[model samples]
Target: MKANPISPTIPLDAEGVHHGHLRLPYSRDDSAWGSVMIPICIVRNGSGPTALLTGGNHGDEYEGPLALFDLARSLDARALSGTVIVVPAMNYPAFRVGTRTSPIDKNNMNRSFPGKSDGTVTQKIADYFHRELLPRADIVLDFHSGGKTLDFLPFCAGHLLPDKAQEAKVFAAVRAFGAPWSMQMTEIDAVGMYDTAAEEMGKVFVTTELGGGGTSRAETVRIARRGVDNLLKHAGILRGAPEILPTRWLEMPDGCFCFAEEDGMIETTVDLGEKVEAGSVVARIWPIGRTGSEPHEIKANISGILVARHFPGLVQSGDCASVVATMAD
Candidate 1:
């Protein structure tokens, strides 16, 4: 593999707090000699565990970036014992315009992991993380929320990994983060996810799906803020006990979602956190083109709580209507 063109403006290995950018050369029609400068903050003390905290995996999500940007500005190096690397906006291009994928290459950053070094803008960013940043971290927290297409109940989540020991650690971290709900997630596609990359590298990885709708609420932002602090505490990177809170455990299995069969205006029958039985109608899609036609019903495939739902009023064919996650005993 060729060396990534992305270069960090701050020293990765140091004994104090540093704020800089991950500069990547980019040439476009507007500026022939322009670059993408991704902001980064590294706070390190004496040798200890390093926690890599990232946000804006998808440009539309806001909770992670809001919390992380605050952390970058307010975190004191004197109050830390390890390294805390914060990248508030991983996809700077998309984040700037509030899109889910990078505007430069129309590439979804979350799905472009372990990317080609000499590829497009998004691929180069992923390659930089894969080859350079991920190798130095002992624990990784990549923040996510339902973007413009969907909305979710605030929750901290971890995938059902093959490694039980690693899974245990990851779940423990999720518990320590203390969101309202703790989830054992099932990804529909994990081929090149950043989650898969970090977990494969044996790093304790935990992610989140706070409230969505392409925006952030103060409540969701607080959850993100407290969760990151608690994670640092749990990793022994910061000097404090994790503030564990009571959380309902949820399990999302594959195919636990209901999809819209036809495009129309979606009428949600169930709200987030509401429970529904299998085969129950979760949403109805009414045709806007013709008023007299019967609406298409979208039903739940599992008996569980509605954890996610599409955000927009109108729905296209094949859009997810709702996602149900079973209660964990």
Candidate 2:
């Protein structure tokens, strides 16, 4: 049996139409059974800087990948001045299994970046993207969602420190998302994630979390569509007034971590974007099957905007149960 090819290059037009595929190696055993090649679509215009749009790093996150598909179909190359590379699905194995990591390597693709040439499955794919795709591009827009287990409130996250100029560009691209809220993120190194890698490489990149709780929501699609349009408009690739929503972009202040004190069933008393007072109870966690049992109240650690709440009612100890964006004094 012939081994499968990896990094298959698919040619696309400005309208995002797929014309053909270019195969790239995924592993040493390219001719081995069940080996697979990742696919990328190149839409070249030769006028503007390359804008690379990627999705499906986390396979369970569907909206971003789907939105990229839509973008490839609708975008007009004649109007675009630069190259537009669309990797609709980055984690082929994860996507095949409908999970967050490569089933074969048991690795998260997002965490593995600037990968090695002679590395494992996930690392090799990351290496290919970094070497072949990233260097040629001036900007990158990485689409994402809450993953399989959580439904995130629509938002954007990127490094906010001024010294990281390319990171700042990533944030600006995210701001083009027009999400109701944009968060200046820190502690991203806590996990070796993709956006962090993008920052390290000095590439302008942004990751959008629209919605996810095992399925794609229409609202999520709508928000993602508007986000793509706005980003294109901001990049000067598209000529139109993309709708921008009233936004509340914030910075997470000191003592901002929301560590869960104990594990239990969470009951949120407020929604996303609500204001809360310091030491106020935002949610209560009850013991399993003890509805009337005395519940432990989860209080705000600092006074600020309630930017994100855990969508799943159940949580484990030390998990991020909530987030409060502290207001400036």
Scored against the true structure, residue 238 in model 1 reaches a CA lDDT of 92
Q: Which pairs clash in model 1?
A: none
Task: Provide the lDDT at 234 for model 2.
Answer: 76
Looking at candidate 1, the ten consecutive residues that score lowest on lDDT are 252-261
Model 2, span 1-329: residue lDDT tens: 22322445454434433534435544345555444655566766667777778888988888877888787777776766667787778887787778888887898898887666677778777777776677776777887877765555677666664456665677777777787767676653535566666666677777777776656888878777788778877777666666767766777787565666778888888676678888898787778865677988888888887766666778777767677785422
TM agreement with the true structure for every prediction? 0.99, 0.84
Question: Highest lDDT, which number?
Answer: 1
The number of clashing residue pairs in model 1 is 0
lDDT agreement with native, every candidate: 0.93, 0.71
Candidate 1 residue spans exceeding 4 A from truth:
none
Over 4 Å off in model 2, which ranges? 1-6, 11-32, 162-168, 188-191, 240-244, 289-293, 327-329
Give the per-residue lDDT of model 1 (tens digit) for 123-151. 99999999989999999999999999999
- CA displacement after TM-score superposition, residue 248 of candidate 2 (Å): 2.0
- Clash counts for the predictions, in order: 0, 14
